[model samples]
Target: MNTRQSRLDVLHSLRERETRSGYGWALSTDVPPGLQQSLQTAAAQGLVELADREIRAELSAHEGRPVLWAARLSPQGHDVLTYLDASPDPTPNCTPPSADEQVIELRPAQMDALRVYANLGPVLRVAPADGLVERVRTAYFDRPGNRWRMTLTTEQIDSVAYAFYLRALSGSVAEANWFARKYGVTYRVDPATGRPGAVRPRARTVSP
Candidate 1:
């Protein structure tokens, strides 16, 4: 299972336990010993939060070092886990839509449409052609309005296009849009409003 899934299982296990439960032993017993380390890492990453201060103290006492055990999910972590749980798997092993299918080259207008769709959520997949696999990527929701955004260098355009082609092969239009919005390097004008369209990074521009 993926890291998020493993962390989710750990969180569920923790939630099932009674309050005041010990941390170290509970973690070793509940999750695989190998995964215990991952759990700790997850905690450090703020993906999971411990319930009580006493548990941290106990862990520290046992380890004879200062230990921090607040595994509560941060808002971003929660969003990631929630998205992972909800999104359909878009790996390459999944069957493609069809053989002998033509690759869809995204137009500037289509790319803009994709950006509008992707700003709504964090997880998106895109497929653009046959003989290619789905490309899956995560987006960070920007502050304030929570706009989904991703940065890619111009050289990465082919990689991004491959991803979009894969999503298109999977017949996931929404996922395709997300991939386009996150990676498309072209722009288009809105015919109705006559406003500046989604910003497309130039191939010569390098993301810092």
Candidate 2:
């Protein structure tokens, strides 16, 4: 199995537990000592949170050895998992978006229409035939680059996804709908004009 895939699986299992039972999910349930040992590694990497008692006990026993994980994922871990959920195994092909909280994939039509968006002439410099998807996976994640990709966080998507949608609308309804479906962008019908316009992002965060 892939290295990160196992860890992601382990973490996903933990997340499922958290999803089902909140944070009180038991960490001592795994039968294999190796699996338990893997937990320490996850904790040491800060992907999961472990109790102080476990930490103290492990340190005293191993004295700088690999730490075992038994807790749920941290906020950063959760965000990372969402941002990195791409195809063909657990290998993440996209770089984490810069200074942001999400990364949304862009459809081809939106990519075309977004080029004509207002004042973007000086923004997107490299209109690669593939639209920087390869480069984004391996290199840059600047504001313009991310926006050009439509790979944005919730706030950025809320504001920019709409403009691109409108721009696409002028080109093709199919393209506009494709973009809207990607982010589930919603509209409020204007009271007087009764036209569906503007954009609203579905809540991606919730308070516990």
Candidate 3:
């Protein structure tokens, strides 16, 4: 018999062991009992992801039925863990950063909630541009040597969009075209759908 580990414990362990962009620990290998359940629960809530032997969960989703025996912290899980370690920040000014137009629009208070997902997920950073104030670009690193790549899941992206009263999917051409009109927002066509959307480069990652 094995003791049941709390969800927090499992998440912590996962993050410590597998925080990289493309790695996973096999749940069936040396993981504790009930870990698979915990992982599944987290996955259902957009925390951990259950993948096949190779950790190619995304490809399996498009290819066929997946084996899903490996597990790792999802982008949201990383963000959740990261958020727990930090205090809530009040610097968003109730507006999401418009850099790169990649991260989903974060509400004033909720904006800082998921910054961990994409290494601060487009949090507004101010800098000097030719002696003038300027907005920091998404994935911009303070040091050129600190770049560590990371990416968010489509579910994570869509969730943020929907949370801000927008949708990643446009049902009609008119709706797609109208996306550009929101708050003076510009539209970009998602390569997967070729439909206009309010965000772009949905697969880019950020790391500190």
Candidate 4:
């Protein structure tokens, strides 16, 4: 059996015995060393606690050695088992954004706003303007030859919108909208449900 299955069996065994605050497993003399090692790992991951054997029968007959031989689920381990036993929800239907869907040209301040917002999610805060500019420069614009690319690509815009979406979803809409309006951008509203959708840049006015 795979290591995962073996570990799972160990956990189930503990459950079957309703192992509480005492020496848990008294393995047979034939149990493999690999499964014993697996138990050690499970203990390390906060899944189970292994205790030294309390009885002579719990010691390995062949090795004539005391076994580190008891198991009980930790609080985290119990939570994992509970989640695994629960009914799972169906997968949601979702479509990825197209390559050039609603591309927006960013002004300098708008770009900084996006950079700061993306750096911290749902925090309702921004770094200093200069600091944000330095970060954006270091991350995307700065080149090996000390050159910089001023224009933002569709991919960059998509990333900004996605980050904004996460922030808005986390209940920071008011703060997000304030920044959006300040930067001449708006969080897209879903026409069907009239909820905030994606972040989009405003069209530049052509002054005659």
Candidate 5:
């Protein structure tokens, strides 16, 4: 079994208990040895916390290590689990996106007008391609400031496109417009109307 997979299972079990009992979940001593490492790794990832209490004194005495009793999912952990569970396949590849590609995958249904506070601070809310969500989340949560910099990829574009830098706050979108034009991508803003851009078919006049 994959260590990360086991860790997620453990978290799910604990989370279930918390949901039913209205209390924090504790680690059971009956846990498999293979899961011990996974538990530690989860804790390191801030997904779970280890308790210092001595619930399994006998095991600690026999194993020459302190028994970890309490463990509960952190807020971020909950969000991550929710995100992962919603995926078609929960097993994540966890591969980092290429630095060269800089386009966000937009849902094919409609390219809605998106607003960003700053020219560089826009975050696309659409679903990313396979294995890309986790990487984006990690980079986003790990960093400070409203400025998020990473390569955005979309199914609409080819694989070789590079990533772009985004900033926060809304003002003159000249930079955004320029970037969109530079890459031959469409922006929701119309230069003439100074409003949300829309696609309209060519006007046809009826015979007089």
Candidate 6:
């Protein structure tokens, strides 16, 4: 069977015997001997963890173990369960872009603001102007490069807005305005009386 089928089979077995046994399956049997291998695969994939490795058998723990048995969630296991539980649904209508989408280049000042907001580590060295934005854009799009790029989500933006008034603060208004314009988001402020005008760019359409 394929990996998906094997995983489903293993999960099914675990779900079935969850309440009846000594911390799930003790060992695999003729009824389904490949369960051990499936568990190992799940452990490798982060869905489970090797809770214990005794001379007799290896034990695996799932998410419920933490809540039901007061077990601790290992960092790796926690990341895996979070991914599995919160993964976005895939739909036929959603498709990845075939070619690079046109991206607005970040100005030097804007790049500095992004770095500050995103808490990027010390700038190693600035790239030349000609290829800087393209490189930055690629880093922004790549999940593994999240450390360097401004990966602010909508919710995070809202939180930041509540925490501080960027426009009212010294030396921050321009950068704040630039970011607000780029994302087409407006901070909560009096439209008629605010120092920084509430005007923002039209929201850009994005593809999945």
Best by TM-score: 5
Q: Which is the winner by TM-score between candidate 1 and candidate 5? A: 5
- lDDT for 17 in candidate 3 is 57
Better by TM-score, candidate 4 or 3: 3
Q: Could you say which candidate leads in lDDT?
A: 2
Model 4 misplaced stretches (Cα beyond 4 Å): 1-10, 17-33, 53-68, 87-208
Model 1 lDDT per residue over 50-93, tens place? 54778668766876776543344445556765776666343323
lDDT of 3 by residue, 103-208 (tens): 3332323333223222333453511112111221222332344431112234344433332332223233332233334323334556778874446434557886
Pick by lDDT: 3 or 4, better one = 4
Candidate 5 has its poorest 10 consecutive residues by lDDT at 108-117
lDDT of 3: 0.46
User: What are the per-model numbers of colliding residue pairs?
Assistant: 18, 5, 1, 0, 19, 0
Q: Which pairs, if any, clash in model 2?
A: 39-68, 39-69, 40-67, 40-68, 40-69
In model 6, the Cα lDDT at residue 12 comes to 51
- Give candidate 5's total backbone clashes: 19
- lDDT per residue for candidate 6 within 1-208, as digits (tens), equals 9977566555555545443444543333322445656666766766554444441232323323222111122356455445655543322112332343223334555555543434422342421223333333334322343233322334444433322234236446765555556655555555666654334345689999
- Candidate 5 has an lDDT of 0.47
Q: Each candidate: what lDDT? A: 0.46, 0.54, 0.46, 0.51, 0.47, 0.42
Per residue, candidate 5 scores C-alpha lDDT tens digits across 89-165 of 42333456666555343221111112221112235443234434433443321123333233455432321111211
Please tell me which model should have the higher TM-score, number 4 or number 6: 6
Every model's TM-score: 0.32, 0.35, 0.32, 0.30, 0.37, 0.33
Off by over 4 Å in 2: 30-32, 54-69, 85-208
Report the C-alpha displacement of residue 75, candidate 3, in angstroms. Answer: 0.9
- Those runs of model 1 whose alpha carbons end farther than 4 Å from true positions after fitting are 1-29, 54-74, 92-103, 107-112, 115-208
Q: What's the TM for model 6?
A: 0.33
Better of 2 and 6 by lDDT: 2
